[model samples]
Target chain A: MEGDAAGIMDKSINVLIVDDYRTMLRIIRNLLKQLEFENVEEATDGREALAKLRAGNFGLVISDWNMQPMTGLDLLKEVRADPRLKATPFIMVTAESKTENVIAAKQAGVSNYIVKPFNAETLREKIEKVLAHA
Target chain B: MPDGLRGRGASAAAAPPPPPSAEAIEAAVRAVLGSLEGDLTAKEAALLAELEALGRTVRRVKAEIAALGVEDITASHIPSATDELDAVVEHTAAATNEILDCCETLERLEPQLGGEGQAALRGAITRIYEACSFQDITGQRIAKVVAALKAIEARVAAVVGTVARVAPAADAGGAAASPAEAAAGARPPPTEGQALAQGPQLPGAGVSQDEIDRLLASFD
Candidate 1:
């Protein structure tokens, strides 16, 4: 079981985190680092995130829902529309837990959702579940 | 006598002149009615022009109020500012907890380290604890911003209410989309992204993580 857990959680996968808040970016980055995911990148909004996603071969995406110009939901839609990027695992980390939002995100092909004020353990669990399915 | 004087005297002597002809009396009455109608039409046109000018003035006032960007300030700036401040509080509190967690982790590892390493870890933990003081200061400062934003929001709402009352028709389709009516029919429908991006939720307002997990599981 421990070996399986280690196999599922490949620590070297590159992670792209999207948020408009610098502090949140730092916090998530630190938490990812604590989880031994050292290869983490950050984008301030969904537009920059899309650009980066198109430019790089990211293994996972953890994004916030609210941002100017482009939102995470729009980014998700764009990713899903693109055949090449549609298969990448995506986790939405946001404070939007409204049933409609959850249903919308689920329909948009989100792999998992984590509410805000979450700890490292919650993040790890979500990440593990996402990657395991990936 | 001269012929002209003789004719005038003869007409003056004409026995009582017959009452004015019917045609002549009717012409006289028609002239008076025409004058009265013309006066009434002119007055009506003037009154209508005044009313149209008033409507334009009210519209201009509404436009100026919109131009003041009160709607932008209340709808966009204040909400985003408060959200940012709330994020500050959330991040600081999270960071403080993480720092404490690190300190505890270090303490647990102290027994495994040499004397110098243990001392260094202990000192580092102390410094981290000291750094956690920022959370309190930041929270207090955020509270101030929140209070200021509340005051501004209230003032903007009052201005909006006054405008709405003064010229309800003018503001019927204007920038009166306050936060309260954001979900109502008075506001334009939100775009898909705007609808989905509800920002952060208040405590107990959002669903729990476990509930979300269950919800997602049900989707399968």
Candidate 2:
């Protein structure tokens, strides 16, 4: 629950995947699983994600751009606005790859960004980049 | 209404959402654009945000359909797709602008999103990942989605074929219309279809080899 990526870390990393789409969530989990990051969890959206975050210690967050009640952006801002969760690196998985969204996410303090329909390497590269920068 | 009839399509209830067309797609986009156009009042924004979410779902569905090589179905559903798409793009523009607005707001208040507020936000970001990254287990990004769409296309084509087939039998006994004509008649009007065919032409609409090549450029 509290480690960085294995190839990245000496041990494993705890990652949380948040998206309303079950398939997308599965896809991301499978991607991270490929990277050997075994300690991962899933949440349907931000509200549940908040619950899990409160319940456990997580290392990295890879979240969708859109979701109900709270979006990944909102969650990002919320995390930034909160004391307990700030400073944790967050990456966004977005279908909307427009320049504006990326700049906004960056300003909001996202660790990095990846467009949706992304593969293992794009994901791994982004995660590694974020961790290294952090 | 018959006893056996009830079980005939009983399996349909468990089917994944039927690509979200008609009323569903309409309602989604309307909410989407409404949310985006600054048309939503304070309370309406919340509801519209939800609609924008649905628009994303619908778009993803269209993407799936496109991947399946079922161009006809996409063409047939073009009205709903275009409407939903227009709404989504517009709404997303709005939301992205909103995020921009908020960042400006934050900057005016504090240059940095500091304190515990920042901590929780960062934590939430990390945890959300553990929940959603299954889309890329090993590497293949488009493979699973492509596979799922192929299966659905097979199912939908089968259903459409069955529907088309049923009409021929109906026409066989003294009916005059050919199956194509019957198929044509069963559909709603042609206005939307016509507009779609004649619509903005999507730059490179079809999933041609070039487009596939562009998408696969990374892996290749």
Candidate 3:
């Protein structure tokens, strides 16, 4: 899967992981590192994620669903609405996988969904799917 | 009798000789009762009016509570936060389990490995140790969640007070008690809808990954 998507899974590609939980952010960062993808950044919530998204040229945006003041869904909408960021591949990583939540994310143009307690392989598959689709 | 009354007594007696009529006495008695009845009726009407106002206030409070969706907030929103905490617990467990697996792997390999291999395994073990630090961060996140639950509990207590304030004067003593008393007496039992309110569900208990994939495929 490493060379499958024209090196879309390239280790140096920058990825932004947004989560309110520091543990979750570190866990994800470690998993990405395990996958040989090290150029990772972090944000605490959707508000910070939006600011970071504006400032950085990230290849992938991975965010958690539940957050204060703004949710990942809201961030997705903001990103999609912006012409500059509209084409950016976005993935939702959350513990909540309710049907309504999934449907909403899909409608808002989420690239993929990864439930919590996932493994490195699952993360790899989700990233590959998102990048390939984009 | 006085001397002046004694002098007039025969004349007074002559006039009084036409004895007081029974009909006149009956009429006086009737007049007294009528006045008393009027007063009683007015008092009853005032009491009834007060009761009606109380009823209206109670109904308004009920409507306000329904509008606030207190049940849903307690049943759904608070529990959702709880579910996130549950997920955190599960994630913590998984992280610990992975670390254990790494330890076992290293233990088995330590006996067979040479010097450089031992160093490589040590580095791997160190990384696992660092990853396990998630528990500390999870602890911080749990504290935040506990704070949030406390806020929700306070809000629920406030709502209880709102409902209790509508109690009639007769029940004022009992109703004006603390929110806990009000909740203990009036809170509805957790409904079927509230079953999910306990915590983040297990894989089989919640929407399965296969189901999620199917739903995702639908969007495509």
Clashing pairs in 1: none
Misplaced by over 4 Å in model 1 are A1-3, B1-190
Question: Mind giving the per-residue lDDT tens digits that candidate 1 earns over A1-134?
Answer: 43466577878888999987665676677667657798999998889999999999899999988776788898888888888899999999876778789889999999999876566667878888788878
**True contact recovery of candidate 3:** 0.17
Query: Model 1: DockQ against the native?
Result: 0.33
lDDT over C-alpha atoms for residue A63 of model 2: 87
Q: Please provide, for model 3 over B153-212, each residue's C-alpha lDDT reduced to its tens digit, 9 standing for 90 to 100.
A: 656755544453222331343334344455656965542212212223445755666677
- Every model's TM-score: 0.56, 0.39, 0.54
What is the lDDT for B83 in model 2? Answer: 59
Model 1: residue A95 alpha-carbon error in angstroms: 0.9
Single-chain TM-score of chain A, each candidate: 0.95, 0.89, 0.93
Runs off by more than 4 Å, candidate 2: A1-11, B1-220
Q: Candidate 3, A1: how far from true, in Å?
A: 8.3
lDDT against the true structure, each candidate: 0.73, 0.57, 0.68
Better of 1 and 2 by DockQ: 1
Q: Per-residue CA lDDT of candidate 2, range B1-220, in tens?
A: 8867776668667652334323345565775675476455877777677767776776666556546655465346544544554565455445544543453344344426789876665444334443333233211323334434545544555433322332233323333444445566797664311212211112243233233324434332
Which 10-residue window of candidate 1 chain B scores lowest in summed lDDT? B164-173
What is the Cα-based lDDT of residue B17 in candidate 1?
52
Alpha-carbon deviation at B123 in model 2, angstroms: 32
